[model samples]
Target: MKQDQDNCDFIIQAGHDIYYTHKNVLSAGCDYFEAMLKYDTKESREGKVVFKDVDSECVKNCIDFIYSGEIEIPNEKMNDLLYAAIMMQLEDVKQAVSDILKRSITVENYFSTRKVADIYGLDAVSTRCRVFFSKNLMKISMQPGFGNIEKTDILNFVKSEKSGLYEEAKLTLSLRWVENNRKNEEHLHKCLEVIKFDKMSPAFLEHLLESNLIISNDFGLYKLFNGHLLKASKRLGKAKGEIDNRDFIILFDADTDCIRSLDPIAEKVEKFHDEKFKHLRDFGTISLDSYIYVPCENKSVHRLDCRSKNSKWEKMKDMICDHGEFPRSVSWSGLIFVIGGSCHKATNDVETFTYSLNQWSQLQNKPTAICDASLVSLDDSIYCIGGIGQDGVEVSSFCRFIPFSAEWVDLEPMRYPVSDMGVVAVDQKIFVLGGCSGGIEVNYVSCYDVISAQWTSLSSMIACRSFVSAHHMGNWIYAVAYGKVSNVIEKYDFSKDKWIIVKPEVDQCFTIYESTFVKL
Candidate 1:
């Protein structure tokens, strides 16, 4: 026994043996002790446990068990090792044994066994295990207790069978916490907590009504149950005021041949939002040949008017300096900046028309001339993205126009070149949606980040459209009409990151050339 101990110590000191064994062990079971002893042997024990027979291999194995509390086992010998670890109640060894089994198990089989492993408090082992366990898991529709789980997570959970959740996660996840877990009757009774309603969906309002938590006295007006009518009524109203006293200007393309009245259109808008229209009585409209600006009293929109076609020509020449035609896509920064359009029979000349002192003045030319592109004003700067060029080819280059310095700087291009696309500014971010690229209508939505100077693709819209018109209202971006004739209006909510299909209350026959939204 003394010679055997010396041999074991010699193997450990040689670094070949990395484990150790204990002497005078507890008499829990001989099977465990025998397995532990075998675990300590580097060679096949052959059911022998005598000190005289223990060679260098046995000394190495004993040293391995002493230091690491683990013995490397072959694939074929894992089952026996697991059984021994379980019998010995060695949690760390059992976990190691489970890990070995998991590494070999197929993804499909791993899922099924993971649950069994989890139930036994072996979550650490089970978590590292991945299996196609979802296939065998039964799918059940259970309303998620709406206690603050993220919508994306809920949606993913509901779509997977791993959880016995429902497929309506998109619908239920957007609800408030009080509405989700209705079992807490006391919490539900605290309904008078008059919170400001920033986003109000028709479906959400309907859900509240169906749940008996709210009642509507009139269409589009909602009141919470056991709450004051005044507070509920105020919360449900839309259009607060005329954007304070600041001059709110609207820019629109009047499509040369279209016959439309700016005031009646404004009045019609007021009728749809009766509660908010009361404050718009002081608003005015300025109509140009094909462009109109609301609160027409704004001096910026008036300065661009050229009086006659020849005067417009002289104005164009004086403003552009290169004697080019007007650009189809225009953006306002106190003055109008025009880029590549039909110049001298489809010429590419980027020019700026300054509105200060009521005169057209030229600015720095664009790096590349583009037409039918989407233009947006964000943070006192203008961005031009994706359009057809003078060569009748589509381009995706992005350019910025600085008003104060009168300079043009090139920026990173878009992922796709889209012409005749609708662009809208929402929350200081520009969204370019639905346009003709590669001679085909595209439904891809791209968002440009001013801060990061990067472009990210968003969820595609329901329909493919080009020449679309987009308007931003609060957290929603409403896109309406495209192609030959479309009455479809799609509303995209950034908060929910979901699209809502809505029918505009206005007449369907009227073609909307340019519509402005005023949050009254």
Candidate 2:
């Protein structure tokens, strides 16, 4: 083969039969290939060589780069390409890769990149990774992948002089790490040694000692923790003035299937992916005993544990019988009440599900058949709002069911005939949002006082829409419609007695929706 050889050459195979060539163009640019071709080696003489270890995709890209002086390294594959370039001693590709990696360091992947760079002797890239980690350890430690990182790698950073962290954050992060990785209990002490307990506040150290993490078979480590706690607890009082963790625990039917939560401070929406129940078309949801109970289609009820670390939506026993479509529900004294919501002739059916017994029973029916109405429970009674009857007449009457007396107590009805109304309970008062009346959307907002047995008309919502979901947080009421520009999420202020648009509303979605407020 000559300098300008026009002959088939080396084959680089990977993952079965995938192969690429190291031709004249590659030999000129790559020192390894150049050496093989120049020294009268077997590859030079035979005009055919095979690299069994070369990655097929990577070698193909290298060949393209050697010939065209251009190649792309995707973010996910940059490390692989860097390794290939260094092995082949391709100066240009190696330099290009190192520069991009050094400049593109992120908290999420800096530790991983640092590990790889250290092995490859990429000092500049390694330095950037170390710098990023040291500068942002507090924030980086809170990242999603931090708890899953290997203990050895984290210890390596902790041992570094450049790791500019005080012992306070280290204590918190270590506890969080163990909380997230309970399976890694064997590595607890090894990880805890990195946190400087001597520098932590006495109150914080006492809190740390109170944590059940010290309950280990390693008696020596346990004694050492208690030794620190004995001295710390004697010197300090109960911890105070820490960051306030009070938060709203929101539970709402996002769609017909899944439930969602809204964090006012975090301003984030988290969906209960496992809680989705297909064909769910009713607005029946209640929070009781730290679980969210929802009624779905096919007469099936599902529950999601609000207090569980690993919560899942589980199907409960079907109702004793169908309360019919759109049956309203409320939870009180460990019992769930499902009532009202039907088509054709209105039916006066009421079903109650007992949480402790895991059984369903019939409750006293409403004074009259109520369909498409709303139910809200306050104390020992369940209040049923307006609905339409089989005679094609809108019901202006409202009633409350007293569980203790096992009797129906009629309450003053809304000023206007209402159906498909949005009802939410706040304190001793119940507020109803906009709904449809006589097949037409109405924007009438009404509030009923339970103690006074009175109905008070408040400010109306921004739009007239039926099938609305309302959530109560503190003194605010959030109303979201399932029909029409559902994008507008409105909030009702009890103090101001007015409705305020929450700006950028929730995403548009249909299906019977429900909402509950959780204050933490």
lDDT for 269 (candidate 1): 21
Report the C-alpha lDDT of model 1 over 1-520, residue by residue, as the tens digit: 2225433322122223233333323212224444545464643243233333223443443334434555666565454455545544555666776776566544324533454465555665565552232221111111122233233433344345444423222222223333444343343232223222323322223334433231333233244422333343355444243122111123232322232222212222212211111122222222222223222111122222211112121122233333222234444422345455432223345544322223343344566655567677664467877877767778788888754344677888899877867788765578988988898988889988877888899988888877666776545777765322234457787877777665433333344444443221
Top candidate when judged by lDDT against the true structure: 2
User: lDDT by residue for model 2 over 1-520, one digit each (tens)?
Assistant: 1223235356554456434455666677778888888888877787655656666567667667877889888777877787778877887888888899888887556767777788888888877876776666544554445667677766665555555555555554565555556665677677677666665444344334433343434577667777876665444333352222233434445444555656654444555334464445653666664456777645788776654436667778888656666556776533578876555337787877755435576655666776777777775467888888867688888887865445787767788898877788887788899888877998789888888988888888877867776777656788876632235467777778888765433463443255654422
lDDT of each: 0.45, 0.65
* Per-residue lDDT of 87 in model 1: 44
Residue 213's lDDT within candidate 2 is 46
Clash pairs, candidate 2, are 249-518
User: How much does candidate 2 score in TM-score?
Assistant: 0.49
